[model samples]
Target: MTDSLAIDAAETVDGRDQERGSDFARLSRRIVQAGLLERRHGYYALRLGLVAVCFVGGWAAFFAVGDSWYQLLVAIFLSLVFAQVALVAHDLAHRQVFRSRRSSEIAGLVAGNLSIGMSYGWWMDKHTRHHANPNHEDHDPDVAPDVLIWSVEQAAVSRGLSRFLGPRQAFLFFPLLTLEGFNLHVASFRALSRPSLRNRGLETALLVVHVAAYLAALFAVLSPGKAVVFLLLHQAIFGVYLGCTFAPNHKGMPMLRGAERLDFLRRQVLTSRNVSGGRVVDTVLGGLNYQIEHHLFPSMPMPNLRRAQPIVRAYCEELGIDYLESGLFSSYAQALRHLHEVGAPLRARGSVADPASSK
Candidate 1:
């Protein structure tokens, strides 16, 4: 790795004109030709079947708990099941599971809207833009003008709640993520209600089903206090589970200025970080542990990411580009450190400046 670093530095200084982007394209072609793009139908079937069991079993357990304090425990379990279902929806939106785009869309709607009360169309629009331009403050919805600032420019413009939270964001990051489940559901409903959005009726109907069924189940099985507690536990854990999985993928990595024109390969690899873990972590993150590979090949099947890791890593090493991989705990630490660093300007200046002026 040290030797490769030296080579990378030399290439940067010498202004190499070797068309490195083409090399990336060639490697991508090789990966496809090697059948890494092929769907593993049996694997997906098994995984989705297990997810179905969890969802059904979780709800069954909740109903069975019936006024018992143990319903809290059941609620936590249900949150995990919902998180797994969301992961499946993510894969479906990426078109990684089915050959037919229509099949993937249908699955995404069922898992996201009907099951999780999130709009598939809303998520798809945001996520597709994110993939196309990760970490860009302007183009990437994931990083765009959020309360948690990722760049000094964003911090400089912080106001209201964001202003109050700017200096304390690192400490608040995980706590804030606990609310993301509610935030996402609200965002989905808002998106579906937009007059310009197509198929709003379908998305709205699915979300209505999810909300009605979810509330009905809780009211049927538990007292008012227990129901409130159950909702809190379920949504909080669901949010944290999602945040823990996704925050590490790009939070501590490079932030792209919207103006820069980067090749597909450089853009993806540079902005993404891979999490290092075994089977349990992989299962929880749904192969998002291999974020670098997933970003490079967004449509690739999840089961194939582990197989492609070595190939991608070696190629990156040969190209002398950095390929970051860290344990789960370390990744979170890195993200927090970054959040702290970006917020420094806000702390030091003690005033919000115009973001345009920062530019």
Candidate 2:
């Protein structure tokens, strides 16, 4: 293994100007063409089973415990499962989770829309734009304007509020910013619902299906208030899971773009960093700690992330790429203070046009 990695490393050094992206493309084609994409059927079964146990199990726990305290616990568990659902749905979007296109499409509708309140077209389109221009100041759709940054007037108003309510807000606010519908999807959903929409009918139908399913489940099980509580608890879990996580990657730092042509791809790889305290945190975070890998190899399955880590690092390191990284808690802690950090004039003054700028 070491010998092979050494050769790959040497190849990376000489292949700097050799257009090895195409080489890797051809190489991958050969490998996958040799009966790799034709997957056995068992992976789909396991995926279905896990999805069922996670989503259904959360609702079951809510009724099974019947305690107010347990509601929060079930919500937390469900939130984790939902995070997994996001990751899995992402896998489905890229055609990694399910081998069959039909299976992938159907599963994506269920997991993406019904499970997560995201229409497949809406989420996939944004994700596609994200990959096309990650961290690009001009193009990457995911590089949306942040609400964290405050103008001078706003900062003045927030000074007292931040001190008095910052910690409390941190406790509850992290979940609010990153969940599917609340913060992340607000802009996205609005765009999807526009009159000039591309797939408005299909996407709206999916959105309706998800809302109707949630409402039906709520009405069938308990009173309306309890159903609302269930929904709130559910959103809260995902909020924290996504809020802390999604924030860490791009908040504290500036979005950088590379040269022309490879502009966004370079920004993504150079600007993204991997957090590594250990395997425990990495697994829980769905290997999102490996953010650079996730960005560069978006189609790669989440589980194959750790496997590709060393290769990705070696290649980028040889190319003088800037890979931002910190420990598990430190990255998130930095994220917690991101709005403040970026709010500072010193940090905010310089535009993030270059991918090399780091605080």
Candidate 3:
């Protein structure tokens, strides 16, 4: 009798979850209209404008300002604008927010190369793999043998270099993992057949020109020291935005066995979470803070993010899936703490099979 009752309770819970998922599915259909017809177009257009302004205005600010904190402000402006551009590039590469492949690829290259050196084909491959198998222990490229979640067997396996690097591996591993730019460059320059020949060569040329332009702008505007300051300051601050914004989309969240058990609605709620932001921040961040919706419906624009939540919440409730949402600072803090909890390979190396490796 008890066993039968337990099964019933579980089924009831799952039923409710499915109902909510169905609701999100319905909401998704209503929302994901084609093209840049909605506010999303406007929002992206505005962000693109801001990126242009920052590029032009940053230089103006550098020339205008003397030795003071004003330069820092300009740097922040450059970084923030450039970060949005990078996110757009990210979205384009993902095919999340664009209508056509050519347009997305073009946007991705223009933004990515200027903002961060990225190769189109290379980024596409790695990112596709990441989304395809987010948290699988073995198959997911994102999960190195070292980047374990929580399993005794997994921990035991984390011996040697994995054990040694377990604590700060993600940080150190970033440079190698995100080397698409270098990868593309080499593939274009080195490969005999040159598979990505035209695309890679064009981007490589653009990148060379971009560097040269920056150098010319540097000498024209200010001294060598100031130019270095400009690049370093913007790049580092942009790093902060990149690290936090991108990490939250998946890292602390539970991984899936596969997308099998996932419905469209559950996929978003279960696999993703949201961080509340003001209109300015929301717009600037590319609606990424409302990450759940963004992940579920990449075509939905940033302008609609504010309006999309209430509808999405309704669906989540019916399905019984948790719709994680919180203020930005709170989420950031939570992610940080979760980092150590998730990260504690406590010993010189926590045993892969050892539960004691983490609480």
Candidate number achieving the greatest TM-score relative to the actual structure: 1
- In candidate 1, list every pair of residues with a backbone clash: none
Worst 10 residues of 2 by lDDT: 1-10
Best by lDDT: 1
lDDT by residue (276-350, candidate 1, tens digit) is 988888999999999998887777788899998999999989988889999999999999999999889878766
Off by over 4 Å in 2: 1-48, 63-69, 99-102, 150-181, 184-192, 195-199, 257-265, 336-338, 346-359
lDDT of 2 at 140: 59
Instruction: Give me the overall lDDT of model 1.
Output: 0.83
Q: Sorted by TM-score, highest first, which candidate order results?
A: 1, 2, 3
Per-residue lDDT of candidate 3, residues 224-328 (tens digit): 787677666666667666655665555556655533555545654676668776786676566688777665555455566677777677767876779888776
The per-residue C-alpha lDDT of model 3 at residue 73 equals 80
Cα displacement (angstroms), candidate 1, residue 32, comes to 1.4
Over the stretch 270-303, how does candidate 2's per-residue lDDT look in tens digits? 6676788677776567667878766655555556
Instruction: Please give the lDDT score for candidate 3.
Output: 0.58
Clashes of each: 0, 2, 11
Q: Identify the runs in model 1 with alpha carbons over 4 angstroms from their true place.
A: 1-20, 351-359
